[model samples]
Target: MISKIYTIIKGTGKYIPHLRVKNEDFLNNTFYDTYGKKGEKSNQEITEKFEEITTITERRHVSKDLVTSDIAFFAAEDAIISSKIDKEKLDYIIVAHNFGDVKHDNRKSDLVPSLAARVKHKLKIQNPNCIAYDLPFGCPGWLQATIQADYYIKSGDAKQILVIGADVLSRISDPHDRDSMLYADGAGAVILEGKESDTPIGILAHTTRSDTYQFSEMLYMDTSFNPDSEHKDALFLKMNGRKLYQYALTTVPQAIQACLEKSKTPLSEIKKVLIHQANGKMDDAILKRLYALYDIKELPKDIMPMTISWLGNSSVATVPTLLDLILKDELKPHKINAGDSIVFASVGAGMNINAMVYKM
Candidate 1:
């Protein structure tokens, strides 16, 4: 039998910020609705409801001095160490983020140097052949970057690629909006490498879709709801939470099902559904609908492991960070054995959705 080259995750790493902001932390702030009016409900009531729906009780925030690229570099370093590979051997470094680097005091986005370039410089990688770049594909950015790396590896153009996702949503979050409580800061990284094998062992299949026509503005940046705030000129990340949740419910499951069918893998073989940790309720609904696709009702226990209760939503960092936790045995009772199959999926801004089917 002829050998085939496949892209497989060689190693993974994550950086969870030290500053833990709890639900009570938002109780003192005055929140405003999307309509720019003061929140009708009391801050206490709003906080409790938000926690109940999103299941995010506490989230991590980066140190006042650390920026997005700083955390990205840290995650990359951890991944490199975990992989035990020479930094010079990497053929590509793709950093996925949205707001670049925004400082605490000044909420301006600085992307001139490109976060990938900054991370490469910080890594002290002198190889000119190791191309580095950035990808800002909403929350699915990191998974999308991994897909890009898979193409390069399969094409024999890249043997090793590092994909990093880091976001400091706290700085870009609108403090006056209840959604701000869902935003967190964290970074995760994974190194994908080409492996020759007689049978497929990794990256079996993948699918992605962009629904920009009708849902282009579901998630965007705008002036804060608090018009009188000091950072009025700066754009804060905003979302039509209800609409985005609806879109994910309608499309994300289909995308994952398509990927599974493309891989010719049966539903029974999928051991895990590692999806983006956006909203806990939304994820739960999406999974139920996914099973509804096959006319199944009862969902498997522990098919999905979530960290949002403590980690919050870190945009592109969510899925990879969750993967790292399970891989390192930090996430309890969740383990990936030699033959277990898994699915990775995410949906976010750009109204984009993607899914990848992999085998251990």
Candidate 2:
């Protein structure tokens, strides 16, 4: 019989830069001066604007002194140390990033090798068989990497894997764009070890689906900064908010249901639902629909929504980052017990939807 693969989440860590940009600070310092006419707008005017639309209280940005890889390295080091696992035993490092040190090169292939080398040197692991690579799938990249790593470890190709998700959105965000307000910079890391156990806290089942027909609803590119040109905003993240919301509301539930079904677990048995920290409204909508459909009342009151009023979205790092936050709290009374389940879901650009069930 094939040895059943078990991936235990040994450790989790996250890093955010020192610099903090509050909503009021952003409006008073930049928004009004840049967008206001004639003269700078008063503080009251700025406050009014923020209150009109959903107000984002604060967000963290990578300091000018640090780069994307620096954040990733910090998180990775913390995770490795926290897990108390032998560094020499780690045989793989997988990075899920949408943006990375783009100033040096545009292609992801070029940057990943440099990052891997830096990580290997810092960790001081001299295993010649160690391998490192990158996976790009926007917000769902981390889940994809987890499944891939599990496959590698199960095949005896690797003993341990360090999965890192990092993104620096401020670098690509168009300063003049309001949509840019939704993004922040951060990194998260998780150490997974190959082990045989009846109970596993790692991935139990994961599924992904893509609808290419709606690909153009959200996108990013690099173009000139000409103010007069119609394509001036092409370089920054753009999304048809209404359409994207519709897609998310419809797909995420189905994905979660599929994951639970495949794992042979009932939705009501899940202890917590760790959905992507995308938006407060989107999350609420998804849960409401779930409650109505499944008639399950075990949903915990401690809903984790780290993205809503703070970290807009960090692309691939969202899920891992949230996981780090939960673990740092010691899991508290909200701890995920053995045999209990948690649902991880994300719906992002490319109209992609993914969900995974974890049996703790």
Candidate 3:
């Protein structure tokens, strides 16, 4: 019998911030338009309308005492303990994030040592050969890191790899911008190991694209919309929400189509789609468009389990965190069984979009 190495998930874990932020909490925020004008609508009207569109009733934010690296280490520890794998034997510690460790008081991104190195240190790994790195390709960083890990495992250079996605978006969000309510904080990690098999199982095929020429600034950072603020230099996460929604709807489905064609997996076999929880409405449109590519009108029920309504957008952490929740039976009625094919995808800053198909 012939055997081929395949990348498979050994264990998964997530750190969902205990701090739950409800939509009503933002009713007192003084939101402003892009032109520095105060919001015209009443705060109640604004919050209600925002919830109607984004379907986000609540989100999570890290505690005041914690930073990005701390949550990354927590999630990584959960994955290690769940897998019962030797932390010292890890081949790579890949952390995906945009802003580094952001402090509540300072609000400045700290990337001196790289979040991966920080996590490796906090984990107390002693292996000198275990490579640590960071991938900052916007929100798709975690999935992209997994794609890179697959390459090393396939080449026989690595047998075990730890990939984490985390971000403290609340620290970087502008309270004056309505989009601030859409951001959150959390971390999720997974351990990937190479297993010999006769057929493809994990990470069957994936595709990625960057549309920086015209769409790079769809989501960016800028000073607070409040012109009177004392901190003029502090940067906050900003977005052209309409343009970003359109851009995602235009491109994400195409990438998923390319992945499906590459894997040659029929649409009917895809049991689930774990996508970055950027926006609930936008995600619904993406799923519909994906099915439309195959010329199918009706969509499957519960095919895409979402935490965005409650978890908000934690950038890189969304997909991996959602994956962990389902893997642990915390997300009910959505389960992955052996041989079930699933699609994972995301779209975010860098104007980037990516998709991967995995068979469990």
lDDT of 1 by residue, 191-225 (tens): 99999999889899999999999998999989989
Better of 1 and 2 by lDDT: 1
Candidate 3 — which residues are off by over 4 angstroms?
A: none
Those runs of model 1 whose alpha carbons end farther than 4 Å from true positions after fitting are: none
> Candidate 3, 332: how far from true, in Å?
0.9
* All candidates: TM-score: 0.99, 0.84, 0.99
Residue ranges of candidate 2 with Cα displaced over 4 Å: 1-3, 28-55, 102-114, 199-201, 222-234, 296-299, 303-307, 330-334, 337-339
Score residue 170 of candidate 2 by CA lDDT: 74
lDDT of 1 at 239: 94
Over 1-360, each residue of candidate 2 has an lDDT whose tens digit, in order, gives 444667778888888667787666545333312233323556556545543543456677886766677788888988988899887788898887776564422322236455656667667779877787777777777777887887887777887899988878877765544556667788888998877765544677788998877564566464423344344434655556667777777778878888888988786677778776666667778887676568766554765444546765777777887877776763454555556678888777666778888776
Q: What is the lDDT of candidate 2?
A: 0.71
